[model samples]
Target: MELKQLEYFIVVCEQGSFNRAAECLYTSQPNVSKVILSLERELGRPLFERSPRGLRITPYGRTVREYARVVLRHTAIIRSMADYGWGKKFSLATYPSNMIAHLLADFYTHWQERYVVEHYEGTVEEVSGLVARGQAELGIVYVAQRQLSSFRHILSHKKLVFQPLDVKEACIYVGPHHPYYVRDSIDFSQLSSQRFIGGVHDYFAVEHHLERVSLGAISTRDLNYAMHSNSDHVIISALLHTDLCSLGLNFMHQPYSHYDIKTLRINGCEPFLTIGCIRQEGEPHSEAADWFVEQFRQLL
Candidate 1:
């Protein structure tokens, strides 16, 4: 199939409906349907099962979807590499964190008119892949100390190196109305009854363990997850409006004070995580990339 066909197919799979996918692609529904029909005819395999109720992706479609995503990601990497150092575009990927978001905000304010910032947020593995594939100049992520050896080994295979910025203590975030608001420290045992806003589980299974110990030695898998999301905004809203607490590092809570969020150290257990940036080994950081990281160094 053509690249456009694969792109359209992936979008349809994500949107789960021809009409919605058409809307997203800014095309007519009939046009999408025609493309899918042509694709199925060529492949001699149905991608979607049609029924009176709705469309369901077939087993073959699920496999194709994964392959299509990899193809698109690789294509993007190629395009990005071809355009590297050509303009003011400075791309960076990062794990979701309020601290990084705040640093980016301040960085943009100084160079908004002069530079083009392409910022992406995801899990640690996703961020590393972006840098490894040359799609991003650098990636910022934190790793649990216990997992650092394995994490670094994986990065080495990807031709990337992680440079530690700081070691952060595990902290729990609570809203102003939370009962723990007045407390300066909370033990993992005391958090058993607390509702948590956990991360959305996906392909990165290792992140679950990393996220669990981010607030110290608690059995977060057994803790009540009131809501799960990958969006920082959603997590912040949950913390502000609901009684949902979040597990993270102390530095990650840098901007939480502005929102009246309290950061309490986890007692009895201390999980030290190294916050750092990853870049392709032997590749010098671009001026903009260095400047972006320098801001973080100043903050940390």
Candidate 2:
């Protein structure tokens, strides 16, 4: 049996649906079913019982799945050992973000002497295309829940695997002197009462959702939308001297700790987004890229 076939079967068992299995496997439903059926034919037993909801693992399927894990794990080890990078250069395309930049720095500083690292920062669409076309070895991107389906649809078309590295909600950032700084969290609608400061390209992915939210804020006391620039320094400057509030990640406070910025979740509006490391499905990652992914994942 082919390696892909076994992978499909195992994933189908995990996800329970042909659709989800196909998505995780980066293939079509019928194709996934075909592979599983092929495996069943070879083994002379049904792996799953079909149903409207999804597939249920048969008793024999459980037995097959137990061994499949061992086989796939060993296969990965062999592949990594046998095809380890000799001199392959590594390229990574990622959307601009403070957390991602810091993580990349850690990896680059640790491996710079032994590996050459090429990094590209751009919009999610641009970097996804870059990695999809083989211009880069991997990609790091943040997809808000609203955009995830379309984003994954695009990646699936390009046959790229989406590996979520971290997940977090976007929080409000204000100076220490702000009245609400002492509060654990702020009501979502209360945001309308604060003057908003934002960056043209936010390192935090919250900007997209905030734009939609600000439309209905309709608060005369607080400035609805203030000027935003490409520079985070300018944005932070406004927050320090003015009553303007901006959106940011919780951990980002450390980088600007001297400025005394505080981060707070927006009640009823704090939706989480998945930050993922993407690579070409079924393709071998360069040793440098694999090492970086491992280290970054560990750091998270």
What TM-score does candidate 1 reach? 0.77
**lDDT (C-alpha) at residue 187 in model 1:** 73
Among the numbered candidates, top lDDT falls to 1
Per residue, candidate 1 scores C-alpha lDDT tens digits across 1-300 of: 798899889999999999999999999999999999888898899999999888999999999899999999888778765543434777899877787777778878887766677788888888998898777898988877777899899999999998999877667889976888888988767777888886666433323553455443556455677788989999988888888898777754444357878788877545467888999999977888888888887777
Model 2 per-residue lDDT tens digits across residues 1-300: 888888888888888898898899888989988888889999998888887776789999999899999999778645533322553457788765555567677777877666666667766777777787676788987777667777778889999878887776767888765778788788766777776776555433566655444343423234366776645567767777777887665455254255666777776654467777889989987778888778666655
Clashing pairs in 2: none
Q: What is the lDDT of residue 93 in candidate 1?
A: 96
Pairs of residues at least 3 apart in sequence or in different chains that clash in candidate 1 = none
Note the Cα lDDT for every prediction shown.
0.80, 0.72
Cα deviation at 265, candidate 2, in Å, is 1.8
